[model samples]
Target: MSSRSLPTRQLATVLFTDVVDSTRQLAQSGDQVWARLLDALDAVSRSEVRRRGGELVKSTGDGALMLLPSPTAAIECATALHAAAGQLGVTLRIGAHTGEVERRGLDVAGMAVHVAARLMGSAGSGETVVSATVQALASPAAETYDDRGELSLKGVPVPVHAFAIRQASPPPVASAPLPVGDDRDAVTRLLRERRYEEAAEIAPEVDAATLAEALLAAGGRVEFLDVDITLVRMLQDVLDRLPADDAVTRSRTAAKLAFELRGDPSTAQDRRDLLDLATQLAESAGDAQAASEALLATVNSLWEPTGALDRLSAAERVITLTRRTNDVDHELEARLARLHALVEVWRIHDAGLELATYARLAARLDRPELNVFVASRRGMLAQISGRYDEQARQGEIAYTNAVAAGMPDAERLRMSHLFPIERDCGTGPDLFEAGLEMLRELTGIMPGNFYEADVAWVLLTLGRRDEARTELARALPPLLTSSGYRWLFSAVLAAETTAEVGSAEACQRLYDALLPHQDLLACVGPTFGGGVGERLGLLALRLGRTDEALERLARAVGDFDEIAALPWATRARVHLASALRSAGDIEGADSRLAEAKDTARALGMARMLAQIEAEDGGR
Candidate 1:
């Protein structure tokens, strides 16, 4: 009977680890030193194997075998095993293969057994090898692996894309480089082997200069939002480090990558980074087309609930970007020109005053589009301020022109904003409702993100969370999944509906998701949805994250102050004050509560006054 002829049966991720140059190390050190090193390794491997939910199967005198349940668990085990034996110069190389194996006596064996041993032969010391099958099982959530493109193995008729588990710093490597130029006929062979670090080295040597655009086009084939973002940022940093005029294509690449990344529901830093890179790239390229696209990309990132309105600075930066370019007459320059015009004149002053200035400017410019945009924002300011009559008039103009101009999305939104004001003032009431039904049709035709978040805001205010949730589900089309504050839409859905539906679970999950994403939202609306922070904070307080609740509620006050949402501001202050009191600062809390009552009274928010009274009474 052969010593290798043993078999063991178990469900496991089969693993292979080998130390490189073991015979040479033995030749350099005496027998006693080698024996002690082997003893140290056995002890280290045993402890680490147990720590990683692995069991030591058997010791092969020098190499030991281990088993673990999942590929992730196996990789984790192997990483720990490699570290534990590092100090003794016993450089451990491991290959993991997971499958059903036959068990006989104390030994384990299967077809994967040969494969794992063969893979271990391929790896240098201080390395771990994993198969492509294992990589597929780890997908997006598992945080480690460096692709070693493809390699051919002895007795394996097929090739494979192998991998090494990555660390913050990998061990120093001495290994053969993978040969260049992958043959199309070797797809199976490619799938079975890896030339990981070699490919990255060979990539730069490929004279990308000769095939720049083709390489870019190939790179563009990478479409995952997160991956594109990382590539874009790297491209940006690379371009920035190089002297200007060194290569125009570098900036173009940066712009392309950044623009693509911005389309993801990624981090604000990611979106903002991409936009900034795109703008800088455009400036570098001296290309009008790229500049216009980058500017629009920047604007697109800003159309979310500012809950703080900080992104208005970004929108304003686009205006500044528009001015820096030589191509002021670029066909796509209109949006920036209009945005700059609005920013110069149409922030949060009194609606009546802003309207007169907007009306004068529209007449001076003789532009209907400018008139519609400015009139709509001012009118929204009026309605939320409860200046009912002025709200009605601007709503009429914005909706009427949008219809005449064939801007149905704008028309639907304008009419939607008008409805509550009409209901309040007892005028054009049916028209607003008719406009909403019309919006359901418009939602299907609009070619953009979350035109429905806009529609839902009105629906939420109308006390229609159930109906709004249904419409919102319908309204949030594929394009809108990439929309800014998408997480906020779901949060608003819970915040708006939870009080009525009594679903604590939905509200809690919604709150949890929203709180993390909230740090970067910059609201652009004229509504006190910013005050929704107080509502959310109060919920968090009930959930026992009182410190978080207090911090969030205070931030809400800052947004309210900027937008002059006094009534909502006062309401937010009361909630925050109550939270502060609950958190043990009684004097500070009392002063805030008093100030809230005064502001709510002056702003004529009887609802807020009643709420403050209840809070004070509770205390």
Candidate 2:
């Protein structure tokens, strides 16, 4: 500490701007004309830099280097210079990077300066490109940055995540505009109103920007309204018209269309095709961030029984690509996707390990919104390990941090995970009442039969057999199709409900559905109830297969013990006792019951404890 010198480096935003196609312009206009233009551009650059609170370090004949205090200032100066160059009958290609730079006598020297030059070299004609750092530091409203993904600059030591900067305004219309003002607004309003035929009549005449806007507006009404195929086709047509070399625009458009189409079952194949195209375009252009986004969309739409392995593979690819981009936010999303896939395929141990690595990397970002996601995964692990205290703590951190971060979907995001913890170990409200309320709120927000199985289980726990049966009936159909990521856990809850009141046919159907994946843990995102073996055993018991029930239940007991999931272990023992009793082993039955009752009482598992007492009373 004593030997270390005071830090000489200070943070700065370094910017570079060069005349686009200067050589061609020089050859076409002669040296005198080009020289005069350069002089005027240099004067304009210096003036703009001073106006935006920056220092024009020096001119490089055809370009200039500048130092600014902030990314926003740098971008404003760049935008101003671009306009000024336009007046002088020239165009510009600009780049910016925000990082620590060493001041060198009215100049700057560091990786930041070098990286800015590299970025400028990568910029297309009339475009301003910035490193991910600059994009992150600048206000989002300062400019419109189209992510160009991870680019391999010629002299840069590492790949950089770059974005092309545009002014914060509506996308420019095509060279030949169709309708203007009120006329264009009419078509947009028609599209939003779901008048597909009327909108489609004018869609062919509309510009790409207008069509994209209408499509997004229509897509956002997915829950209450349906997206017309005509609208999708219109946007696709515009995307097709884009130049083949415009990979960034193409990839982004395709990805956006695919995402919006996800809620439409009829567009399953369309979504797949669009996502594939997006990935191909991005990859061919060496745009890692765009590729990562396309792959993430694919993984998010996965629901088929055989898709887990594919999902894991895709998620890993996304992580690799996003890491190259050096975009922490996207990388975090990719890693979380990978974590979910690992859990889905029953690689719980691997998921736990990866989560640890994810946590360490996320800590450096200091983003509370990201922290909420990390905490939720940790809570899931805690649930599996029967560490209810830790689970509750993590849940609180996630909820509080989500609120603190002003995450709009904070409640919806954490509700499903939090409900389970509250149901199992909360000291606040009556478990059943609070659980029912939370489920209702979640249903209101997400709608569908998404929570019907959960509702049925809660009802069954409350001894409302008739109501549980009704909800269970509503919940069964989605099990046969794609119910998204929560299918396995929903199946688990449905299986538990079926054990009590289901017909032999229903039990057999669920058994067939669950038996194929007996090796995987039955969990939904971060919520683990128990192993699949126990669920299978319970269904077997309901089907009167006592011998198979005994075998499966015994295995489930061992599984619970191995994981130290106290609540699940206790419940498994209770089920094992019933199986043993059915098999007519009185001593074995009583011993298992005694062990289960002890754990239930100590853990304050009132529902399970009541079940044990009820069984004892019947005996």
Best by TM-score: 2
Candidate 2, clashing residue pairs? Answer: none
Candidate 1, residues 1-619, lDDT tens digits: the string is 0011111123356776666678888889975566556655655665566665666654444666777656666666666667655656567878776544543222345445555666777776677777765666543323567887675655433455577766623222221221222222121111112222323333333333322332232222111223333334444444444455643565445544443444444444664665577567666777655665555544444433431233334434544555566333222233322332233232445334534543554465433444555556666666545555666687777667644432313444465565544443332335645655664544454223244544554465455667766654554343223443233433443454443343455447546545544543222332213334555776677666889888888987776677665554665787789789889998888999899888766655555566678878887
When summed lDDT is taken over every stretch of 10 residues in candidate 1, the lowest stretch is: 1-10
Where does model 1 exceed 4 Å of error? Answer: 1-249, 263-296, 301-318, 324-366, 420-490, 516-528, 541-563, 570-619
Q: After superposition, how far is residue 135 of candidate 2 from its true place, in Å?
A: 22
In Å, residue 206's CA in model 1 sits off its true spot by 13
Q: List candidate 2 segments past 4 Å from native.
A: 1-194, 199-221, 224-277, 304-306, 406-429, 477-482, 508-519, 547-555, 558-566, 585-606, 616-619
* CA displacement after TM-score superposition, residue 456 of candidate 1 (Å): 7.3
Model 1: how far is 201 from its true place, Å? Answer: 20
* Model 1 vs. true fold: TM: 0.45
lDDT of 2 by residue, 1-619 (tens): 0000001123468899888888899899985566566656765676677766677766665788888867777877877777777777889999888764543212345456777888999999889898877787676635567889988866443478889986643212211111124345555545544576787888878776656544543433323124445756766786877678878667767866665454454566776787789889999998886787678766654433345665578778887887787766556656766776676565768889889978898788644345676787899887776676788788878777754543323454466566666555554446676667667655554444357788888888777899999888877766644344456677888899999977788899999988876866755545675677789999999999999999998988887787567788888898999888888888898999999999877876665677888877766
